[model samples]
Target: MTLNCLAVDDEPLALGLVCAFIEKTPFLKLTGRFSSAVEALQGLHTQQVDVLFLDIQMPDLTGLELARVLEKSGAQGQGPRIIFTTAFNHFALEGFRVDALDYLLKPFNYEEFLRSATKALTYFELIHKAETPMVQQAPQTQPIREDYLFLKVEYQLIRVAYSDILYIEGLKDYVKVHLLNESKPLLSLTSLKALEEKLPAERFMRVHRSFIVNLEKIGAIARNNIQIGSAHVPIGDQYKDVFSDYVSRWT
Candidate 1:
């Protein structure tokens, strides 16, 4: 599947380079090229844009501000994914906060550009797969079971077994999946609520607004806290009654 791209940069040279990169990429098509964010906003209204290569610093409207506008107006909740191309490295964190697919430092080579473009390709491919309808229906007697899920981390999708996930922590727009044996948790650009919907209800429970724990992985429970391995997760007051009811059945 080909992704329609838009290149927006105030610098003539920078804009030319990004447009050339988009032209050379096999799966990306350059739909529009604009010198400023305001011009790009107008272009967005005219055509469908799947990915945006934006420069953060502009005279009238900054790339970051434009991203917010798209989030609210375009493509429901899933707006066009952005790949911020800028000279400054400090805006990297802000770019990620806006859910950019990737950030390309200015003066980057074709190889670097391709790497970022490839990430956008992977992201769109995943979205396409998710949106596709199933061919056949399952029998009433037999239900489909999913043992693992693909979590998007940076550019690649990491396959994580449900059994391996100890718990999930929500941090604004991102979620951290704590695994059984892994020392470091896997960070993905998705909310805990979104992940909760994808997880098996029988095996996972929301013990807190910001935390979801694997029911089978819970090691111990005391007061308003749960122990899962070496980590201690707090149980929010709102979820206390439900958790108590679940524990009462086992007791």
Candidate 2:
């Protein structure tokens, strides 16, 4: 199905660039464009936009803030999926926090855009298959799922299943990945931030600067620590609020 989509960016050039790119993609149809997210919210009431191209920062409502508002109001009626376009990288987690389907870092090329499009379609199909009779008429867009991810361990490429991973700890230059079936970690020379993008936000969360934990496994929790097996991961002060919402098993 051709995706009816909208674009919202303060920069006219950035907005125009996306419109030009959309003209070349057969599956995407540009339905509307807005410089302000507030206007886009108003447009949502009347237009049929299947996907949303959102900018990170704006005058009144930031893209991340707008996404949170949409999700809270459940405004994603027709799979008007969101893909955040941002200059800053720090808000990556916040993008996922609002369950953004994909994130396109600025200065991206057609290949990157194609990759994001494919991911969006994949999410749409998954939700389409799982929808109930009542809500099926509304857009059945699936959340993004990360299956197998790559990690370099020593001289070999280490493959880790999203479900198999328990948690990760970051050192100065290496990350130690603890798996469900293994005691020792599969080490990588990659940052926790880089690896965070490869996993589904719903399945995994960052509880600390040095630790990322899978929500499914929780042997225990004490104070600000998450327990998986015998290991304890400390929750960072900066991420405490976000992590607290998901650590309900312990709370």
TM for candidate 2 is 0.54
Candidate 1 C-alpha error for residue 43, in Å: 1.1
- Find the number of clashing residue pairs for candidate 1: 0
lDDT against true structure, model 1 = 0.88
lDDT of 2 at 163: 80
Best by lDDT: 1
> On residues 86-165, what C-alpha lDDT tens digit does candidate 2 reach at each position?
88888776876565777889988888887887766665654555454426445647644437675655423445788898
How many pairs of residues collide in model 2?
A: 3
Write model 1 residue lDDT over 52-129, tens digit each, in one string.
Answer: 999999989999999888777755245578899999999988887777888999889999999988888887787666
Q: Which segments of candidate 1 are over 4 A away from where they belong?
A: 74-76, 133-145, 148-159, 171-174, 189-191
lDDT of 1 at 158: 74
- The alpha-carbon deviation from the true structure for residue 141 of candidate 2, after best TM-score superposition, in angstroms, is 27
